[model samples]
Target: MYVIIVYDIKVERVNKVKSFLRQHLFWIQNSVFEGEVSRSEFQKIKNGLLDIIDEEEDSIIIYPFEFFSEVERTVLGVEKSPIDEIL
Candidate 1:
């Protein structure tokens, strides 16, 4: 499945969350990540995030798609960290 994660975390834990997400997704923009992953990997990501975030201060939104093609992305400005697939 493909997942897009958008987060608004406290400054103290912001970098921690960012670093964790980077291991599983493409860092497209500030606090935004999108990529494909296996089911097990997805579970691991959620678990890891849960361990890092303080529920009272952090916010994370995850959008999961069965196929990447299903996401109709529109970039109006400079695309940061664009995904370039060679396949």
Candidate 2:
């Protein structure tokens, strides 16, 4: 299954989260990161995100088994595509 993890992160902390995902995930596109990961891997990613975010100021959306096109379309207005690749 595929995942589309969206985020509404503060500007300053975006890079940190992006860097973290870049090291772990495959085919990251926009703020919507894509990858085929085991349950444990997903949890790891979630944990990593939680550590960087302030919770009150920053937000994230993690979608699993999502269609690529739907993921792409959902983020039309989000406008921070740091990641773009095919899994």
Candidate 3:
């Protein structure tokens, strides 16, 4: 499965969250990460994120897909990501 992770978290825990996620996903832009992982790995990601974020003050959205090709995207300006695209 492929997953796109977007997080809105407190500044204090931002680095922790980013470092943890960097071990598993591609950092496409600020607070946004996307990549493919096994089902078990995805579950671990969920559990790990839960451990790192405060439920009361933070929010994380994960979009899971069967295939990355299913997405339709448009870029309007200069891109800041290290990778041009993932498909």
Clashing pairs in 2: 28-83, 29-83, 30-81
Q: Tens digit of lDDT per residue, candidate 2, span 1-87?
A: 557678878999999988888776653455756666777888898898999999999999888863445554444555454444343
- For model 3, the superposed segments whose C-alpha errors exceed 4 Å read 82-87
Candidate with better TM-score, 1 vs 3: 1
Per-residue lDDT of candidate 1, residues 57-86 (tens digit): 899999999998898888888888767751
TM-score quality measure for candidate 3: 0.90
The model with the greater lDDT, 1 or 2, is 1
Q: Kindly list the per-residue Cα lDDT of model 3 for residues 18-74, writing each as its tens digit.
A: 999999999988999988899999999999999999999999999999887875557
Better of 1 and 2 by TM-score: 1
Off by over 4 Å in 2: 66-85
Candidate ordering by TM-score (highest first): 1, 3, 2
Q: Give model 1's TM-score versus the native structure.
A: 0.93
